[model samples]
Target chain A: MGLEHRAKWRINIYAWLLLLPSLIFLVLFTFYPVLQTVILSFYQADLGSPEPFFNGGDNYRIMLEDDVFWKVLTNNLWFALGTVPTSIALGLAMALFANKALRGKGFVRTAYFYPTVVPMIAVANIWLFIYTPEYGALSHVMEWFGHGGMNWLGDRTNVMFAMIFMVIWKEAGYFMIFYLAGLQNISKELYESASMDGAKPWTVFRRVTFPLLMPTTMFVLIIAFTNSFKLVDHLVIMTKGGPDNASNLLLYYIYETAFSFWDQGMASALTVVMVVILLLVAAIQFFGLDKKIHYN
Target chain B: MRTVVKGLFSVLMSMALITGCSSGNAPATGSQAGAGAGSEAAAGSGAGKASGEKTELTFFYPVAVGGPLTKIVDGMAEEFNKANPDIAVKPVYTGSYQDTTTKIQAAVQGKTPPDVAVMLSTELYTMLDMDAILPLDDFIAKDGGSEYVNDFYPGFMANSQVDGKTYSIPFQRSTIVLYYNKEAFKEVGLDPEKPPQNWDELVEYATKLKKDGRWGVEIPTSGFPYWMFQSFALQNGKNLMTEDGKKVFFDTPENVEALQLWVDLAKKHQVMPEGVIEWATVPSDFLEGKTAMMYHTTGNLTNVKNNAKFDFGVAFLPAKKTFGSPTGGGNFYMFKGIDEKKQEAAWKFIRFMTEPERAAQWSIDTGYVATRKSAYETESMKEYVKTFPVAAVARDQLAYGHAELSTHNNGKVTKALNDSLQAVITGQAEPAAALKKAQEEADKILAPFNK
Candidate 1:
């Protein structure tokens, strides 16, 4: 018993030795910056001003009541809701479909994933041409399809969905890779056992396959939700958060508030709020997935 | 768990490593031509001798000439080093006007404040108001006050000065003017020399200018509508903001009427393109003659001169109540916390860069309006003088020109207005509702400032 305790102590020491560098790094980069941002959100705009001061919760109060701030928040929520599930579902759908035997399967998979490899900004340019109100290639294709063109990203009513469509297209392929991994990890023995019991494919999938893929789904959903809040490059090029701030997500608003508006205080406040929101989601993922996680 | 945390940290480090290396090499591959243009500016200057001896000054500037622009700006350090033998100037190319602002805040908070920054004129007021910049009244002592002040056109000065103290000097500035395709005007049988004088006339003229396979007019619907709105509101004798500057008063009758006038040119008239997002290469539009009239900066005249396949003429934008246009350029402001020596070095660079002869050369080379009156009197100015007389108009309009409704939070409120303007023009909303919503939104946006 003494030997076991001694051995455990040695292992604990070893483990801490290995973890020290990361702990130090996290303190320096992530945790410290977050602390700094929180501190800054309380201060007025004197990050480098000749006179800097702490203004209590004034910045937070301002952000909370601001109309455009609420609009931007709503836009972000809409963007997240629009982009996240669609991408995950489509990704899973494509992954499941592609995991089957098919002719030229590799080529088809490669073609589907092509948009993911391209830079978001460059792809946004192509989508801009597609979203143009007149003589855009997308509109031209629509015209050829025997339909009149709708201004994809230009009209305020149509724009969030338009951006969501582009986001789904670019991001679904990326998310599919994870789903593909999850699909590949499922044991063939389970399927064989289910088949021997005269289980249908759908029944087998519902009972065994999906539950096995739960961790991956949870991971993918967390990532997709985080990304939906973060990604707004296309909005920068295509809509510029307009025709009336329709596509202005939280991060884009943070950028606009900091750079375009030159309000670093409010921007930092917005950033803290976003970070808190993300942390809540992360917390949910952490606790909710722990029970369902089956390593074996 | 220990290994997992370690792995994540390593991944993050690798990401940082990749980002740093890639950004360092960015100028080599991406935007090299703009970088090359910046290099010409930095080319002649030599870096300071040894690290300890040189007073290091960091600078940020946005340039049309990319690579050469940095080199030219850093060249100031070299020139200053050679002249003073005590200072080093490191000029950072801060991509666009927007990027410079972000970097400035980041760098300052990071405790490595740049000694000098070449800021957009619109940016100067907010920074000055925020106490982000150091005033240079002492630096103006070398030149005579009134004569020196009178040298540049009045509008140029207004863009630089706030309250009573001068905060910035015009570097490369321009006023928005009408760059019309002479060929398009001729095709429409409208007198190229006789431009419209009112909003209705502007609509009529644009309608006439519209032709097959091309647009009639294009307003860069994204960024610059504020300047145009300010111009018209000033012309209409309406203030976009109150004097104390802590309220939303843009919904006033005169401003509504003025904004309606401009919006009518697009929505009701259908004479202009609906959603040309920005004045992305306005001269290119003029060159292609894609639009009959290009309402853009005087800084773009060189581009028009270079690329146009057809003849073009510059004309004053029509006025309603008073003739006016806002000054749009940049200012050279020294940031705080630098040693007196570094500040002096920055001033020296600004002085050399803005010398009448140098300003003239820059104006001739890049089509930016010369900020120095003496430069306008030079032989180089004679040709553009005979051709456009815009320098005079831009100067004359200084009495009427004001900065865009700018405050620390002006960016949000202004964007709300600009976006609503686009919404109205694009038929997303009617003008009355759009303006009403914009006013409501802007009030909510400005509520913090009011408090």
Candidate 2:
């Protein structure tokens, strides 16, 4: 018994040794900066006040009053609502289509995934040209339908929609890869049994394919949710949150506050708010929704 | 007992790793300076700085205009190094004016600012607020007092100083000008030699020039709408801000009328695009014949000259009441924290880079207005301008040029105005309402400085 306990302890030590590198990195990079940001949120530091001073909740108060902040937050929500579910659905649909026996399957997969391979900044630049008013690719296409002269990125009403569509085009393929993996993981017997029972393709997908892919869907949901908030590189290249902050996102707002405006305290506060939002979302997905997900 | 000892060892090892990671991260702070030193070493190789005794300086500049200006800047640095063996200058090309200011702010915060930088002239108040830049009055006095200071065009110098203290030296400076495609003008039955001279003529000319698949004129309203709007405001009646940089007059009737005319150019007259036109794309549009005439900086003169397959004419921006433009572009500024030796070396480098002959060459090469009045008198400048008379349009228009919109809390203030201008241009809001909202926003932002 004594020897067994010692062996278990030795195993524990080895496990800790294996975890040391990542643990140290997490503590150093993530936790320390988060703690610093939390502390900074309570201060008043800006270009005007380079030397920081404690000003309790003033930054938060200003953020609450800032119309731009509210506009960016609303834009982010609309962006997420516009991109997430549609991309996931499109991803699943593409995965389902590709899973079947089809000619040029490799070509189809490559074409779909090509956008994901390109960098976001490069994608934004390409799309920026495609959205130019008269001579842009989209305008030319619209001209075929007698609907020419649409400013994709310049108009407030269209900028958000345009950005959402581009993000979906870039992201759906990435999510498709996971769904394809999940689709393959299900045994062939389940489909055969469903066919033997005379279940239609739609019913089989409803009852068999989707329920078993819950684990992958859950993981993808978390990733997509966080990404909706985190993906801001396109804003830098395309809009700079222009047309009166119509397409600005939370992270970009934080970046502008910290760097461009030189309002570090306000940036820290914005970051904290963003972190809380992401944490709440992740918690909901992990704890509340995970219980209902079916795992094989 | 053995198990406990193993557990303690594991804990100690993890602690060691945590401390190691932190120590490893310490160099990240110095990485910017290290990168600068590394690039200087690479650039200094041609100068043969084997002595290791030279005072090295990192100079940051932005390329706001088109062309291979970076190569020219690097060549200037190399020439400076060869002329002065004791100093090594590394020119780091920061992005546009916005990106350059952001980088400068980051460097200053990190306590490792470049020795010299060419930031936007409108960044004067922002730099002053941060106390990051040094006053150049001392250096100017040592050089030639008011004589050296007065040599730079007063129009460009308008935003370079405040409270009787000169803070920046004008280098790459520009004013707004009208760029018209001569072929398009002639095709539209207008004289190629005569561009629009006033508001009424502008609308008439633009209407005549407008056709299918072509805009008559495009004043870009994307990147620096506030600067372009300032030109309109100045032409109408008043400058955007006070001379002291303490207050702004954005909601005046003249400014509102200016914005109204801009909106009307698109909505009522249907001569220009209805939505925001990008700053970078406007020049390309002109080159592509998508627009017959464009309001753009004279900095694009070299670019248009090189790329235009058809003849083009450069003239003053059409006046509302009088011909006016806001002087725009970067000014050379020295940082405050450097040692006296480095300061003098930086000052020497600035003077070298801004010498009359070099200024004339720069203007000829890059199409930035030669900042010094004496530069135009130089033989090279005279010869170049004689052949290319359009290159001197911006210089002649400097007489009517005023300072760009710069005030306390400049970024936020300018952003408020930019948003309002964009709103008005996009037809999302009326000119009067937007300007009033912008004025209120600016007042709130500048309230702290007012006290």
RMSD of each: 8.4, 7.4
User: Per-residue error at A28 for model 1, in Å?
Assistant: 2.1
For all predicted structures, in order, the TM-scores are 0.82, 0.91
Give the Å shift of residue B10 in candidate 2: 30
TM-score of A-chain in each prediction? 0.92, 0.96
**Candidate 1 lDDT tens digits, B84-144:** 6666667778887767776676554444457788777767646755556776666676544
DockQ of predictions, in order shown? 0.21, 0.38
What is the clash tally of candidate 2? Answer: 0
lDDT by residue for model 1 (A1-296), tens: 69999999999999999999999988876776666677768877632344548989999998777777898888888888888989999998888887884887797688778989998889888887666644666666777676433556655667788888999999999988898899889989989889999999889878988888888988999989888877777766666787667777877787776667756567778888888999999998889876887654
Kindly list the per-residue Cα lDDT of model 2 for residues B387-442, writing each as its tens digit: 99998889999999888888877878888998898888778899999999999998
DockQ of 2: 0.38
lDDT of 2: 0.86
User: What residue runs in model 2 are displaced by over 4 Å at the alpha carbon?
Assistant: A1-10, B1-52
Measure candidate 1: CA RMSD.
8.4
DockQ of 1: 0.21
TM-score of 1: 0.82
